[model samples]
Target: MRIRLQRDIDRLKKQVVSLATLVEERFRLAIRAVECRDADLARKVIIGDAEIDQKEVDIEEECLKILALHQPVADHLRYIISVLKLNNDLERIGDLAVNIAQKAEVVASKLELPIPFDYVTMSQRAGEMLEESLNSLVNLDLHLAYRVCAQDDEVDFMKSAMQLQFAEEIRKAKEEHIEPLIHLFLISRHLERIADHATNIAEDVIYMITGEIHRHKGFEYHHSEE
Candidate 1:
């Protein structure tokens, strides 16, 4: 029974990793669409969301089956529960990527205007957080998980600064630029939310490893410059 349960758990981990890879690729494409203002790329991301949704559902079903069949306990149980939570976070990140893609479509249609926000940098940081969170989960690296949680605040600061930049731009914007400006603001917002989801994943990793809850408390682990 133990060996079978471990085998099933290993299989579930692989499935979750596959989903993570898909979601991360979609997010990167969404960021590219934002940078290039490519509606074609944005459309691809939007269309790809259905596959992600289906995969998320499939993973949830597998997790349920594992729980019912094996009745995982202790650390094994924690790992399963953490995967379930992080799985949902990953799906939400995919949705946010689609949101960014949809906003990119709107921003693409308009005349190019000066964007005061450093949106590309913010997107890159958010992407890194997502990558690190997934790495933590895949490798069970406690430090990587904690590092991801620490970086969330940086993304949050950029998002707040973006709002200020948008508000200032709004004052001087001509009528035609208003719509694109709004979309840019929303894209930044989505990126910040993506960072939030990434943080949630990191927290789940910590819980899975330590068997201790660390939501809203990961900052305590941010010691050292490593």
Candidate 2:
């Protein structure tokens, strides 16, 4: 029974990791679609969302099966719980990628305007956070998990700054450019949301490993004044 339970756990980990990889690729494609204004690529990401949803459901069912059959205790139970939560986060992140892709599709249909914000940097940071969060989970590295949590603040700062910049740009933009600019701003928001989900996954990993609930700990990090 013990060996079988461990095997099931190992299979669950592989499934979750595979889902994470797919979601990350989708996210990157969404970012690229935004950068290149590729409607076809955006459409691909949007259409691929169903696959992610299915995978999430399958993982959840597997976790439930393990819980019901093996009735894992202590660390093993925590690991399964963490994977379940992480699966949801990854699925949500995939959905956010689709949202960004939809925004990109809209932007692709419109005339190009001068983008006034640093969207590339924001996207890159969010992508790194997602990748690192998954890496932390795979390696069970507490330090890496902490780093992933700390990086969320930077993405948050970028979102706030982008909002301010968009407000100013909207004031000066012609009526024709306003809608596309709004869509671009929304893409930034979606990226920020992805970072948030990544942070949640990192927190779950910490909880799984240390049995320490870090949620709502009031651990604040400083952001740039720029």
Candidate 3:
């Protein structure tokens, strides 16, 4: 029973990693679509969301099956629980990618305008956070997980600044450009949400490793660094 349980746990890890990679690719594509205002790329990201949804469902079912069949305890149980929560976060990130893609589509349909903020930089930072969070899970590195949590503050700040800039742009822009600028602002908002989900994943990794709940405490520590 022990060997079988370990095998199932290994399989679950691989599945979660696969899902993470897929979501990351979708997010990167969405960012590119926004940068280039490419409707076709945005459409591809939107279409790929269904596959992500199905994979999320499959992972959830597998986690439930392992709990029911093996009844893991201690660290093993924590690992399973962490995977379940991480799985949900990855799915939500995938959904946010689709949301950004939808915004990209809308922006692509409108006239090109100068964005008042640096969206590419914001997207890159969020993408790095997601990648590092997944790396922490793969290596079970506690420090790397903490670093991912710390980076969330930077992303949040960028989003807040972008919102202020958007408000100013909306007030000054012609009526024809207002809608596209709003969509651009929403894309930044979606990227911020992606960073948030990545932070959640990092917190779950810390929980899985030390079995300590650090969701709030981690935020406090990271916030102090700012």
Candidate 4:
């Protein structure tokens, strides 16, 4: 029974990791579409969101089945529960990526604006956080999870900076750049929300490792000096 339960846990972990990979790809494509102003790629990303949603539901069903059949105890139970919660977070991240893609689609018809911030950087940071969080989960590394959580603030700061830069650009050329400015703001907002979801998953990993709740409480986000 124990071996069977472990197998089930392993299977679920694989499922979650698969979902993460798909979502990460979506995020990458969304950023690419923004950079190149590729409306078709953005549309593809939006359409792919349905796949992520379906995969999330499938993962949840697997978790439920394992819980019902195995009734895992102690750490095993905690891990399964954490995966279930993290799965939700991953799904939401996918939705945010799709939202960004939609924003890019809307702005694609207009002339591209000269913004100071790079969508690539923000998207890369979010992707790194997602990768690190999943790594922490697979390896049971609380420290790595905490580090991923800390980087969320960095992503947030970059997003805000992008927004401010876009706002300034918009004010300078209101009529000429209004469409791109609106889309840029929307895309930045989506990236911020994606970082938040990644942070939530990281916190869940930390909780899975430590057995302590850290949901609503304020946690300091540590930044590395540049």
Candidate 5:
């Protein structure tokens, strides 16, 4: 029974990792769609989301089967729980990528609109955080997970700065520019949400590694000004 459980857990890890890889790819494509202002590319990301949705369902079913059949104990039980938690986070991240793609679809139509925020930098930061968070999970590295959690505030700060910039831009823009500016603001919001999900995944990794409930303890490192 123990041998069978380990086999199932190993298979679960590969499956979840495959899903993560696909999600990361979609996220990168969504970012490119925004950067290149390609509506078609954005639509590709949107349409491809069905794949993610299907994978999420499949992973959930697998988790349930493992729990029912194996009744994992202690460390094994924690790992299964962590996978269940991170599976949702990964799926939500995929949805957030679709949201970004949808915004890119809108912004792509208005080529002349001047972007007021440093969205490129913000998107890059969010993407890095996401990749690193998944890395923490793959390695079950507690320190890496903590580092990813600490970086969440930086993305939050960037989003807040974007809000201020967008407010000023909206005040200055004509009626025609207002609509696309709103979409750009939403794109920034989506990126921040992705970062948030990434942080959640990292926290789950921490839980898996140490069996410690690290959420909402306010232990995350903060920037000097934050």
Candidate 6:
């Protein structure tokens, strides 16, 4: 019975890692599609989204099976619950990537807008956060999870800058350019949301490691107050 429980645990971890890999690949592809305005690659991302969705469903089933078979208690129970929540977050992040790809397709169909701002830095940072958060989950590292939470501010700042630049472009440019501008804005929003999901996953990792919930309270409580 113990060996069987160990196998289930190992299987659950492998499934989560696989889901993370797919999500990371989609994120990279989405960014490339945006940068190169490659509708074909963007279409590929949209089509591939279903696979990620299926993986989430499979992970949930595995979690349920383990719950019923092993009836995990205490830390094991917490770990399964965390995995369920993280699985949802991972799937949502994949959807955000799909949204970015949709924006890419929209931009590809139109005349290329003038070079105003590059999303390369923003994309890179968000992608790094996603990767690190997943790594933290696999390693069960609370410190790295906290680092993921801290990096969210940088992603938010980049998103704000992109929004401002796009707003200025709208003021100065012709009406026809508005379509591409909207698409670019959507892309930024999707990237921002991806970072948000990564933050959620990091918080879940912390909970899994420490058995404490910190979602609504925020990190400020960790240091304060009188």
TM values, all candidates: 0.95, 0.95, 0.95, 0.89, 0.95, 0.93
Q: After best superposition, candidate 3 residue 186: deviation in angstroms?
A: 0.9
Question: What tens digits encode model 5's per-residue C-alpha lDDT throughout 1-226?
Answer: 9999999999999999999999999999999998899999999999999999999998989999999999999999999999999999999999999998999999998888867899889999999999999999888888999999888888988988999999999998999999899999988988988998898899999999899988776644333222
Off by over 4 Å in 1: 218-226
Q: How accurate is candidate 2 locally (lDDT)?
A: 0.91
Q: Write the per-residue lDDT of candidate 3 for residues 9-100, one digit (tens) a residue.
A: 99998998899999999999999998888999999999999999999999999999999999999999999999999999999999999999
Which of candidates 3 and 4 reaches a greater lDDT? 3
Measured on C-alpha atoms, candidate 6 has an lDDT of: 0.88
Candidate 5: where are CA atoms >4 Å away? Answer: 219-226
**Can you write out model 2's per-residue Cα lDDT over 1-226, one digit (the tens) per residue?**
9999999999999999899999999999999998888999999999999999999999999999999999999999999999989999999999999999999898887755756789989999999999999999999989999999888878888999999999999999989889999999888888888998998999999999999987656444323221
* Steric collisions counted per model: 0, 0, 0, 0, 0, 0
lDDT of each: 0.90, 0.91, 0.90, 0.82, 0.91, 0.88
**What TM-score does prediction 1 earn?**
0.95
Window of ten residues with lowest summed lDDT in model 1:
217-226
Tens digits of per-residue lDDT, candidate 6, 1-226, equal 8788888999899999999999999999999998888999999999999999999999999999999999988888899999999999999999999999998898887755754666888888989999999999989989999999888877877878888998898899778888788888878878888988898899999999899996756553343220
Candidate 3 global TM-score: 0.95
**Between which residue pairs do clashes occur in model 1?**
none
* Residue pairs with backbone atoms closer than 3 Å in model 5 (clashes): none
Selected candidate, larger TM-score, 3 vs 4: 3
Candidate 4 local accuracy as lDDT?
A: 0.82
